[model samples]
Target: MRRNQRQAALVCVTNQYSCERLILAGKNLALSEGLELKVLCVQPPEYASGSYLAEIEYLFAVSRRAGAEMIVYYRDDPVRAAVTFIHANRIAHIVLGGVPDPAGSAF
Candidate 1:
């Protein structure tokens, strides 16, 4: 990130298909506002055994195509990490996906 450019971020903390829309939206917003797009994905501890490695790779590819610089953080709380990253990057805006119901099995 340069001093003259603004930055927007997309937080995709889960291994779900819905992140595509976030990436797309972030890309569009960044382009429209002349901001750099940054993407973050945090892998939870349960998936540290490489169960979802392939899906992570797919996400990396998708984010790259969307012109976002993607970063994958391992073994951390997704929400907290997202906030930390956003603050560190001095991001002006953030794009995120819809959260599933807390009572349901997903996260």
Candidate 2:
């Protein structure tokens, strides 16, 4: 958290529209505050089959095109894994809306 160092902003998205909104807001915030932008999409364990893998790739490309580094991961318990990802990355701010917090955790 040094003055010269940049904080990271995490944008959690489930749908295309939300992802687009996050991209716009994330980029603007990053530009304004000099923070790094990261987009995270966590797929449920049940949806981790090959069929969904394609969507993951598509999202990855889309997020990158929107000007954020993207990370896609799978877990039976995404809440826990997302917490881990947030902590491990030392994210300073998180962007999300209308999405309920996972049952066992708060974000």
Candidate 3:
């Protein structure tokens, strides 16, 4: 990456609580020098009512204004989607809001 190139980070928010946490985390990441924050709101297959998309977009804009580029990914299973996105985009970091038990939790 060039000096002007920004490092990208994705934050996966799977729930209301997670979304709030992810926003705060994204803001912090945005403040870092040359880092871009992407807030991805993961909606389940049935619960995707399109209400959170705008919120996600708004957060992305805020991140951009904070000196980092902002983007939003609204999809089923935001975590998995974000992982795929990062791999495709060669993102450097993934900032998860909380610790999840892989064995107990199904993604």
Best by TM-score: 1
Give one digit per residue, the lDDT tens place, for model 2 in 1-107: 34564578888876354367666677777777778988888877666566566556766777787678888777777799889888777578888755656685675
Give the candidate order by descending lDDT: 1, 2, 3
Highest lDDT against the true fold, candidate: 1
- Considering summed lDDT, which 10 consecutive residues are worst modelled in model 2? 14-23
Candidate 3: residue 34 Cα off by (Å): 1.6
Which 10 consecutive residues of model 1 have the lowest summed lDDT?
4-13
lDDT of 3 by residue, 1-107 (tens): 35555566666555453356565676676566345666555556555566666665565555555444444444666668666767666456666665778788766
Q: Candidate 3 versus the native: TM-score? A: 0.54
The local distance difference test score of each candidate is: 0.76, 0.73, 0.59
Off by over 4 Å in 1: 1-6, 99-107
Q: In candidate 1, what are the lDDT values of residues 1-107, reduced to their tens digit?
A: 35565656554546766677778888888888887788888887878788888877787888889887898877567779777777678597777677578889775
Residue pairs clashing in model 1 are none
Off by over 4 Å in 2: 1-5, 15-18, 53-55, 99-107
Q: Distance from true position, residue 31, model 1, in Å?
A: 0.7
